[model samples]
Target chain A: MRKLPELNAAGNKIPNRQAICETLMEAAGRDRNVVALCSDSRGSASMTPFFEAFPEQSIEVGIAEQNLVGISAGLAKCGKKPYAFSPACFLSTRSYEQAKIDCAYSDTNVKLIGISGGVSYGALGMSHHSAQDIAAMSAIPNMRVYLPSDRHQTRKLIEALLEDEKCAYVRVGRNPVEDIYSEDDCPFEMDRATILADSEEYDAAIIACGEMVRPAVEAAKLLKNDGIRAAVVDMYCVKPIDREAVLTAARRAKLIVTAEEHAPFGGLGSMVSQIAAAECPRRVINLALPDAPVVTGNSREVFETYGLNAAGIAAAVRGAEEFL
Target chain B: MADHDRTDNVMKDHKMTNSELALLSCRLREQTVDVITGAKTGHIGGDMSVMDILVMLYFRHMNISPANMDDPDRDKFVLSKGHSVESYYTVLAEKGFFDFEAYKNSFSRYGSEFIGHPHNTIPGVEMNSGSLGHGLPVCVGMALAGKMDGAPYRVFTVMGDGELAEGSVWEGAMAAGHYHLDNLCAVVDRNGLQISGRTEDVMSHEPLADRFAAFGWHVIECDGHDMDSLDAAFREAEAFRGMPSVVIAHTVKGCGSSVMEDKAAWHHKVPNAEEAAQIRADLEERKEACRHA
Candidate 1:
């Protein structure tokens, strides 16, 4: 684990998907058992370099997500660590049964990498978006769900997963946003939330995951500028959620705002609210994409429309008085 | 030689005769019927139909055993027609993988590891499969792993003809051929019936051989109930390199019984006491004829 960079100086952004590909390529270079499988999405996943480097360790299933997962699970059974990469919308829903039964239930060490997750396929419209993946992947028993906020955290998460013999799902965004952590200084831990902001007199805690984490930190800054302190958390481990962190965030502030690029029902918001309502009852304003087909545009435009940006979050925090 | 090396020698050194394998199937079919009758729930029809194929693989061919389970080079098998797990349980138990009584007493009961569908938690079961179309793709993976490692292990799976209707089966079929996985052999129990009706009525997988052939699979058709035919089909599959192989085993739904034979109701129907007696009698007659013949 490295020290986190100053929240104000986040710079030199890299796509989390690229980080996953590079890290997997490096791992496969060292260990022959590390395999990268794709459903004809190597170019989209930025994994063509890995495939080129270790042709033996790369499998192109050619647009079949179900077979991609099933074959990955099969390879896992043969003592291979197969990382099955596919687009989130099809992989999570289309190959869902394969993940549940073949990988998780069968206890195969297949890592499901859902790239272009959430609304990251912004202009491709709802058919290509995966607003329900977090909920779907988390529902499977023995499946560990992860949504790393940036390149550094994605590296940490992949490296940690490589060490364990288990079934896991890793969801990463398509585009590179401004770095939330400087390349030199990103603290990392397996299955634990990264707290970006904490203050004794904080007014709210905005907990987020995947592409939404940086905006959350920015939201904390906006609130701080208005003489209001707020805590920000990167809840990367969505399945085995950081309960203690959610509890602490509940304790640090009066209002808890959960932000994500996923749907409202079964994502980060529902999880935080469930935990807060049970252990530490607090007001949770879950800001997520609506249940309906969201407006089509680029990711930024969609985020802005859904009130998932810094200003929207800051305004939500400022309007927290209505519930109080 | 080491214990495993000796076991390997023993396995290679002594393959069972086709008649002996047939006798073993006769007994296992009886056992399969007993459990499904006692439990009052199972896919008994397909179990009887696929019994000889499973027997031939475990007894005569396929280098998998309870002793050599830790051997990475040993062949992997999955009952893709997983509802037929009752017979698989009997086969593995008979092969000395685990205690028969444990599975006999508590199968499908709460907390019992003898789950209705086969899961890897049990000895000798490679993949947890109940949903159709899952096993073949998984086997394709296993075979591909062996091909990648240049390992001498093969992957085998049995699917019901009805299971071929699942689009994922075709997806797996394409991959098995596309990857040129010669180490994979799939046997379809073409018993001609599913739960609802004859497979053609429900969903036609006819021209099934052509279907698989179109996907680039080398298809072999054989009489499923005959041990020698299964042996020949499997042997041919093993020798056919550079592509995956499929044995389209034509079998009767309830192979060893007059009461259940060709009956779709027996797919999940439990036998009454009278029905069990008749089925057991028929099996005994078949066993005597099999041993003598």
Candidate 2:
């Protein structure tokens, strides 16, 4: 893959969604079988480059999400690797039945890409937010769910997904993200978690996925400065989650804190908590959005207000010490 | 001239005449009723309504069989109305795709491959469909795949009139039209009644043919129960090119049985032993009449 644009003059990284377009364009160029289907959100789904580069391989299904998924499943059955891209809210809720029966139960090789997941649409309100996508996607059998932390991970995940044939849902936020990895090549696997921070002894372990991974890694660094020494693990692949990674973190850390930009009930927090409850039984606190509608703001603003940013996570982890 | 006559003879040997096929339809109804009665749970009304259409597809039209099921060049059929699976299963059995006795005995029993809906596990079934509005879209995909591979295989699917109300069906219709999938043929089992009421009373699809035509499909309206009409419609569909085809097969719910025809209660109701016997006698009488006629 070509090198991503240099970080802004300030040296801050750009969003990961662009990496999705870049990687998909490269994939379409390399593999003729790799096709992309969009529901009139080709621009928003960041698939313009792939559309321009490989018009023959991409399908524009207008505004129909159900047909987007059903047709993708059909193409998959016909021996094509299809990625059905739409905003997470509609892709997970409107076409949910098609995703469940056509793609998952029918055992087709369609990859469902839920763009702008987890309040990434920000001011567009709850109607646009996709906080429950992980919940809806995780419940379906034979569906693999993942959320890459940044551009590097997004590139690796897309490459791996194209090579394998299975039903999958990958959620990516709308905007650029802080770089978590310096290079595209990393120790990435479809079913394993990546440990961003390691510690011999830890006061708490922060497990996170998708947009939350950067803040989680930041929290770990801050906790270390405060002498708390929290270990941060990127639980990118949510379904068939790395249970062994959770157990390892739980054994070393005094407390386990699971964070995600999703509902408190399901998603990364819930999956990790379930593993901790049944196997390790540590003091587990899930940092996630509440059941009520999320407050309207930009993604950074919402995240900051809800204790999801680096400072918020560090404080939450430090405060959980009293409970422990 | 001799070679052509020999080829014609071989074709005639494999293809059942319309009269013979009509008689076979009655026998299939008997077996369908037996399986549903044995299971004590199945969609009988729509099954009888769509039985003749299924016979035309599996027995005569579709280029599929147990031996050629795995061949990509073979035609594909999806039972989109999946609830009418009783008739589909019976027809597949009659086609030698599987054993009728084995399927009839184990249907709907815990773990039987012959569950309530048509699934790929069955030898000749293409896609697992019981949910309405799914099969057509999948067939469109298959047909598109055929066009892409430059393979000479056609795709077919059947849906119930009640199932036409689903929004996804229209979405698939729009896509099939936009893509101009000429290799695809869909048949709507227009049996008038749904569980709640008549299809027109429930959701008037009165301009159904026009609707499909507007969506770029070549539409054919025909009597679903008339074996000749269905055969002719499918033949026309096979010959048509440039756009997808949809045969609007108007039918009576529970057509073969005296007590069940046009009744919504029989939509999924299983017949009791007495009613089953009566239906069997009715089919036997129909078979006798066809023999004499």
Candidate 3:
């Protein structure tokens, strides 16, 4: 297995949304069939640069998310690769049926890029946070749900989507996140999860997805110095999840910890536990945003308060001793 | 291209008069009514209402047939008012898109792909649409794709009058207008009734032409049951450019038979044995009348 990147001394933080825009712009420039659509969310999605650069390739559908999905499906039917950008809060709900029927059921090649997912809007309140996108989008049969960990993985995911003709929902956080992998360090796979840290034997297994990956990596480092070993797996592909990785982690660790910036039910934790329980039957600890309208704060404060940070995850692993 | 030697090559060199098209629609309606009766269920009322328009688009004007199904530049049509699929299936089979006998035997049967809604898996159909207010947006997408490819394909969809109540319909309308998609054309089956009641009572979509016109479409109103009027309306829509065009086809909910005409109660109810016989007799009577006229 390849060595994990230097998580402690990472480079600058880059917004995953910006990474999507840059990658999509590059793809669209190379092929006019690659098109980007925004539902009045070009600025928030970091797609304004793409829109200005490729005027013809960029489609602005005003503020309607349903039209955004429907038109993208139509464009795909006629051989154009459409990347539909919209806020996750509305894109996963308001256009849920369209995504289910028009894109997935119809089997159109539409890539739905949901921006500001999982409380990325933070103080914007419950209305803007898309805590249920994973569950909602994951429920569709032909629909593949993904929440990439950082800018590097986000680029790889978008570029991968442009090559295939299938329906997908991709969620990215709003703010810049600490780099988990350098420009050349990120070795990518389409649906399989990538392991950041794996040990022959460990006291606890830490599994994380999307933005929660960085914190899990940090938590692993914190445990390493304390003579506690951990296996950290980034299960980025939430649907068609890496069951092998989950079972492997179950075999290596005394207990399993799954972290995510989503609600407890129907998220990464739920999927991990189901996989682990069927084969290994290990104790699974889910560290996630509680089921409630979270109080107002920035994303960092929310993560800290909800115990979704490095310290919180490390503490959860150590606290597993009470069960053992 | 062996399919090019189809028996129903009526559109190749024959320019059918309005009455001849009407007679043909009545003859096809006989088969449609039989299928609905055999299937024991279908949206028969709307099927009757939109038969004339379907007949004209398939037989006289549109550049589509079994031969050009593989042609990317061929004209595309979507049945947005997909509940009226019985009429659509009849027309498609008549045009040799598929075997009418095969479709008739297994339509809406157990494990049949030929269900009440339009399924694209069946050859000659474009999008799958039983859901209200989805087909127009897809048509807009196809039209935009044609423009981008510089293909000569014309994209068309038929939406029900009652389907206008869906908010997504307006969203699609707004986008179609904004794009100024002249290659895109939409026809509203302006039948007076829906499942619940009259469209005016269930939802006020009155001034239908004005509604589409306000959405940046060049609106054309026509007699839905008259092939000549529908043909003329389509030509006018095709002639206009710089913005999408819409045809508001005025029609009765149940058109062919006196027992079903203008009645919302017949929206989806299967005709009884007596009613089915009466409807078939009425369609045959109309066909005989047309043959003499």
Candidate 4:
């Protein structure tokens, strides 16, 4: 196996929430029609900067998630591109019917930004954790789901959404996260997945999304140390999963292991498995949160306890080789 | 006749007879019921309840041009109580927005744009709506945009009395009042019934006009089926400034149909051949009575 380098030993400098708020404010400053609607979560969603900077563009619906989406759809219909921000859990579950009818079914250009997604709100309990946001959002047709790897990717994704007219749900992290890409690589395509690690010949491919991408990178190095060459692909755009890249990886590799910090059903793993079953039928293994409610702990400890860390991913990748 | 001659010259230019407008309203409602019964599926209860409001808005109240639907300065209308799309589609067809034939084949074939609700695919449809309680907030946004852009276009939306139970409707109500959308008007079809049972039994929205008044909207109560009252309520809405307006249109659940009137079962019932024939005969009798009157 290849020697794995320490991940973010120096620690993260930028908070993901502030980074997203700044990106939204920057976009609002440039466009007059750009507006932000929140469900009494301007502080929690880190939209205070936007509220202060573009007060005219900020609309606070006061704890009304359904109206938050409905008003945003109305604003979008009237030639405004609106960002509807709220806690991921409530935004995904509480106003799900409105999200389906007002935004997706109506084909409104509304960006649904779900803040503090996927256990990022650790210790606040499972009620706050947005583990099922991906699954819930993916079921709605015409909605593009994006789970960015880090602050940089989140900012890039926000910029990309300003030009994208389709309905989108961006699952944003709350806490500080290590940057996965360089500052120079500021722009990324919505449909393209970034290749963090790869080799000419690989026995297995490690496909990961969102917070799991960093671990997949570490898992790739660990596999290489044990004389196993594993490729890593960051599947950021979960809905329109990069079919070409996933198929290529499956054809070239002996086994494909998908990982995510989300529910196993209808998530990145399930999405990749469906692709593999149809195009490149290969032995696929999925590492994800189970169907039941997750236990309470700090984000890192819970991930490790649930076997969702780099070690768990590497172990799953190695186990899939038996079928190959 | 010197005083009468002087009044005639002054009033002739602005005078509009309610009989002519009422006949049109009756025709619009009859067509709405006929199409729904023919298609064998639709929300006939709410459609009958809101028909007069729709006719009044389309014929005499709102400044809309069927030939110029996309005109930037045209007034906007949102049917928030979207299950009652039968009335909206019939009025739009009669206004020449699209062919009445299209309304005849609604919800029949696959890929038919005219589904059970208002969709953007249909001409003159502002927003695709079927989900209850979504129309008001969207109308608020449109009204706010018109005010911001210095446009004279007004926005009107219809809400079901039952839908007022939704918290989102109240949220939108607060926003519209807070924004001081004087150019915005909302009408509630207070038919007193919903799908399961009477609105009061299902979930009461009693003192509904008081709720709008409490929300800071200029509240007006009127008979939804009366063309004169509808016209008067709309005029009151237009005259008001610095606050949104709500016309609580008291109406029967199934107006105009003797058998279906005030019946909740007709909310989604497909009229059988015998019932349909009876309804057609009643409509023809009403038409002839109007001609003689």
Candidate 5:
């Protein structure tokens, strides 16, 4: 197993979006068919390294998201693996029809990379936040939805997507996140849950995805310190979810708590709840944002305010203890 | 080469004189009505209006056939005004993309491969386009990819004047002109009518040529129903260089039949048996006239 990079002495972590750029550059370097198209978001999407490294493979589509997806579909139709990148907020809503017909319905090999997913845009408010992206993308027929937890998972997800010619919508946060796995977890598989913390017996299970996984893992440790041995599972593959894993957790643990950086409806929570209710009915606590627009603040502040951090998840576990 | 043999094989027997092309257009119109009436679903007015352009592109000019369908350098034709697919499908069948009888038998049937829209599942169909404003951007992508590969293929898309209301059309137009995609050509079936009413009454898209020209495209105008005029416009568009070209072909809604001509009611309205018989007689009469002329 290769060793994972250490956290920065100051900021404490590296942005996962950066790993996407580096890994894509490496992939494009190896395979000439791999291409990347950006909608006037090369800088924000961390695509500069790819643009500079392989100038021929990079495409700039101006600020038109509709054209971006359309052009990528065209490229895919011609037997090229094109990854279209833009802000998640606009890409999901602005060019949705193009994504649906050109990419998904046509069965084109276009990888739609939604950058700055969730509230990673900080105080930019609802317009820039992509809290509703998962619901829209997962609803599409041929689309596979994935949200990687950290840098390690992001690299693996890109590799997996490029290995096949499937339509996928991969959402990545704009900011750096703490590492959930080291070099030992080098190889990763999608549509499968990664169990971070496990025990023979537990009070409950905290299932999280994307950036929320770090805090869920932290909350598990915090709960252990309080004599509550809770299991932490990272459900990164939002669609084609690991139903068996969720059923196992629901059977073993008396309670199931889903955490995500998205709206409480039609997201990780809704998916897990639906599975748990049908297979093994139990009390499922959804730790997610409200239906309305999120309040304006930095991502960390917004997360802390909404009890999405480690302490809040730990507190939710304690709150659910009574139900167990 | 095998590619040369394929193009020659498809074009040899089907290559028609101007009068023969006109006769074939009338035949295609009759077949389109039959399919739509049989399926009980289609956009009849736009299909008749766009039939000449489809025949001109498929049977006459565009270097495409089922033999070279997968060739990377084969010219691409995208039906941006995809709802008018009755005409597009007829032309494709005439060009030997698929058996015309099979298409006629299965169109709009439940679980049949032939759907109402131009799906890529059909051989020789480039992009799946039914929603307006999607075809041009996709053509732009294909054209740009050709440029990147230095391939000699040209990309063409045909849209309706009513489809101009979509803002994405201009966005794609802006990109095509900005990139100076000379290998790309677009045609607008200027039938002057949409589903609701006249294009101008629904939303004024006048100075349409100026609008496209302002976007850095070389614009051309022609009588859409006139085969010679359309041939000249397409020839001029192909000869031009350094910018994308758009040929705005003026046409009447439901061009061939007396009752349907210039009528907006025929937009997506399938003809009943009586009306379908009249349309068939009208096209056959035109075909007989062309046979002598």
Candidate 6:
């Protein structure tokens, strides 16, 4: 097993759910046409501020996920920018047909913000966990999927998507996440991959996305200690993936390993395999959740149990060394 | 006369006689039956039931220009009972939205834009609707937009009696009433039969008119096949203000065909070649009778 790097300090003063609500409310305050459609998840989605700020623009569809999406599509058709907020599990699964037809197929300007993504509702069981959203969203044709790494990225992505008149889904975490960047960092672009770390003579590339990016950065530091340089790439946009960056990494590195907190099918790894098979099909190993329901535990416990931490990712990268 | 004056005079005299309009509706019904039989699949019963309603809207009520389909100010018509898209395509083609020949070969060859339901892939269709409950909300949205923009275009949608089972219809109804969309009119094709059986046997919507009235709409009832009654109801719908209107058109399923009329089995059953020929002949006889009347 490869040695893991020291984890980043926890308890950083990051933005909580209330902060996200306040930011959305501020955006609504600035634009009268900005509307938020929620499916009986206003309090959980932290949309009270938005509801108070713009009562007329806020629509509570009351547990009807299909109607939530259809009405948003209708509103978007009439030239209103609507953000449909719901629990990640139901929004991506129950009303999936609506997402495909009303938003993706119709090309409606509706931003689907799936709150409480992944195992954020850890102890609440698998019903609330949303580990399959990325896999589901990546298969859609015109949908742009964004899983922001932290609050700063989330705010920037929200701002950019507000201006973009296309269908998009943003998978946001429930708990406060560590700030990944300073205020001066450039705004998030849909198609570009952010490179957090790089070495001149890296033997392998450890591509990570979403919440897994922080761990991959730590794992890269551990790989350096073992006399192996690992490059870390943050692939945020999973649908229209940054193929150019992926191909460059595949050509330069001896081995490529992808890490995501999602299923192996139709996730970041599956996306990479499609490109690497046609471009550079050498040894591409995918590190993702297995094909089963995730076990019950807290978020950290679940991540550790499923081998999605820094140690697991570093070990997977080292396992690819046999091919090189 | 000068050329321009002659053209203006021809345009002024472009009105159709009642017999001609009846013949057009008969042609629409025959074409609907023909395409459904040709494809070996379609909703024929509902199509026949709503033929006259569609005829009234397309020929007389709606100010649609087949030449310029995307004209923003044109009156909007939505087939809320989307299972009957065969009727819509027939009427639209007869009204010259596309070549009449195109619909004759519909739903057979690959890549043909004419699918079972109304899709935006077809040029003249406004919304891609096949799901029973989607059309009314979308129509409400369009009507609300018209109200907001102060556009003088009326919005009309036809819902089936069975489609009233969907709760989204009531949601749209409440919204339309709340907004006071007087420029909107919804015509319910009360054919009384759905896919399974009679609507009353399946899920009773007996008090449908009262339901719409309680939801704050000006409710009107008429025999759907009576052109005079349909014309009056439409005229009243247009005159009403500050509230949306609902015209509950009582119609028999499969109206023209005697054996199939009011029969639920013909909801989607395609006719054999002999039956198709007989139905065509019967429609032709009806057309001749109307001309004589």
Better of 1 and 6 by TM-score: 1
Worst 10 residues of 4 chain A by lDDT: A1-10
Which is the winner by TM-score between candidate 1 and candidate 4?
1
Flag regions of model 2 displaced more than 4 Å: A1-14, B1-14
B1-293, model 6: which lDDT tens digit per residue? 33244223333433665556677788889888878877888899999999999988777777675664666666777787888988889888877788767776856457787878887667677766777777676676667656655766778899999999988788778777877888789999999999899999999997888899888999999989878788889878877878999999999999887858899999988988778888888888888877786
Worst 10 residues of 5 chain B by lDDT: B1-10
Cα-lDDT of candidate 5 = 0.87
Q: Rank the candidates by lDDT, best first.
A: 1, 3, 5, 2, 4, 6
DockQ of each: 0.87, 0.63, 0.70, 0.58, 0.76, 0.28
lDDT, residue B258, model 3: 91
Q: Candidate 3: which pairs clash?
A: none
Distance from true location, Cα of B91 in model 2, Å: 1.8
Q: Give the residue spans of candidate 3 off by over 4 A.
A: A8-11, A322-324, B1-16
In order of appearance, the predictions have TM-scores of 0.97, 0.95, 0.95, 0.93, 0.95, 0.85
Worst 10 residues of 2 chain B by lDDT: B1-10
Tens digit of per-residue lDDT, candidate 3, span B114-158:
988888888888778888988887888888888778776678899
- The runs of at least 3 residues in candidate 5 whose Cα sits more than 4 Å from the true structure, single-residue gaps closed, are A1-13, B1-14
Per-prediction share of native contacts kept:
0.83, 0.53, 0.64, 0.59, 0.70, 0.16
Candidate 1 CAPRI category? high
Q: Which ranking of candidates, highest TM-score first?
A: 1, 3, 5, 2, 4, 6
Tens digit of lDDT per residue, candidate 2, span A38-129?
99998888888889989888888889988988888878877888889999999999999899888998889999999988899899999999
The 10-residue segment with the lowest total lDDT in model 2 chain A: A1-10
Q: Write candidate 5's Cα lDDT for B232-289 as tens digits.
A: 9987887688999999999999989986998888887988788888888888888888
Error of 2 at A84 (Å): 0.6
Q: After superposition, how far is residue B140 of candidate 5 from its true place, in Å?
A: 0.7
Residue A20, model 2, lDDT = 79
Residue B282 of model 2, lDDT score: 81
